[model samples]
Target: MMTDALTLLRTRKSPKVFDLAAPGPSPTELDQILAIASRVPDHGKLAPWRFIVFEGDGRARAGEIIAGVFVNDNPEADADRVAIERNRLMHAPLVVAVVSRADAHAKVPEWEQTLSGGAAATLVVLAAHALGYAATWLTQWYSYDPRVRAGLGLGEGERIIGFVHVGTLARPQEDRPRPPLADIVTRF
Candidate 1:
């Protein structure tokens, strides 16, 4: 079991979000994934993050907001571009927006708080993979757009760290090349 867990971590890879299909995690499975995702190293116990789940009709609503913002910002955008934005979240059975709410705290720096949020997002992907699902963590153009941000209900100092798209992998993916350990590692 220990070796299996290690192997899973070692070989984990995210498929393209577009390649993801339906039959996502059930409500209970999602609850478990979220619970596992929340267990991250948080200094001062400042859980400076929250999750916004987009599933079923919720995905369509979120996509519409994104598409609207894209068109508003880029009036010359073609129909294809607009449609892509509109269906961005539709490909995945579930998309969880990890919002970082790091703020000024005397006990914890804002950077550390933000890192904790990133850890949570990473865990979301890992947990989903462990449960036999494909997951991709992404932050597209909409994640930075002011109008889209406001439309998604983000408050001051809140940022979208990632949108974890989860579903079944439509096809197998080849392993990409990894950087040499000697080039990246050094013992100080």
Candidate 2:
């Protein structure tokens, strides 16, 4: 099992587009996925990340919230521009909003807590991949928007790490360029 997992990790590729025509994980499967995703090395035992699920009609509502904010900010944007924001989450059947609720008052460094949130996001993607589904961690413009944050029910100090879109792949995934180990790694 360990060898298989390592092989999967080595070859896992993020698909560019998810198949909207196919079904996503069911509620039970998604619960399992989320459970696996939260098993990260969180220093100080601070589980600083929370997951928000968007599926079915919720995706459309969430998209409307994002597009509403976008249109308000960019009043001159055309219909196509507004539609792009409205359909942002349509790429996949399920979307998970990874919210970073890192507390500054914790004994752990805020940076570490924030990093734990990021790890949770990464794990969501990996867990989806291991489940025979494709996922991509995306932080589009809406993620940084204050109104969108409020619409998503995030607290003042909470921030979005990224949104993980998960579903079957619509097409083949292309392997992107990877840097050489020597260029990106160093031995002490």
Candidate 3:
């Protein structure tokens, strides 16, 4: 069972786009997934990650806000691009924004806490896969934009680690080429 689980982890890939037909997980299921995602390594019990759920009309609201930010940031941006960006939020039935909160008081370094947040995000993807859902972790330009951060109500010390879009796979993905382990791995 452990080997099978490991194999699943190895095979998991982020889906680029999801089906609109994909159903959102129930509140109980979401809570369970969040619980699993929260178990990532934390050196000082300073849980450094937070989640914001965007569903229903909230998704539309997010899209509008993001589009508005884009227009403000790039006056030359075309309406089509803004529309496309606005439509991105409608791709999935549910989206979860993962934020990393840097800890200032812990003996564990801030970098470690940030790493914990990253681990938590990966755990969220894995948990979604285990629950038979397709997910993608994305961080586009808006992720780093101060306006976007303010729209999300994030604090000064918080950063958008990732935005996880979860839903059903629209179709089976063809196998893509992967770099050989030898190319990237170095055994000291």
Query: Which lDDT tens digits does candidate 2 get at residues 73-140?
Result: 89999999999999998879999999989887547888898898888888888888888888888897
lDDT score at residue 161, model 1, on the 0-100 scale = 98
Query: 121-146 in candidate 1: lDDT tens per residue?
Result: 99999999999999999998989887
Best by TM-score: 1
Query: lDDT (0-100) at residue 148 of candidate 2?
Result: 98
Native-to-model Cα distance after best TM-score fit, residue 90 in candidate 3, in Å: 1.6
Q: What is the TM-score of each candidate against the true structure?
A: 0.98, 0.95, 0.93
Top of the candidates by lDDT:
1
Model 2 is weakest, by summed lDDT over 10 consecutive residues, at 14-23
Of 2 and 3, the candidate ranking higher by lDDT: 2
Clash pairs, candidate 3, are none
- Arranged by lDDT with the best first, the candidates are 1, 2, 3
Q: What is the lDDT of residue 109 in candidate 2?
A: 86
1 against 3, candidate with superior lDDT: 1
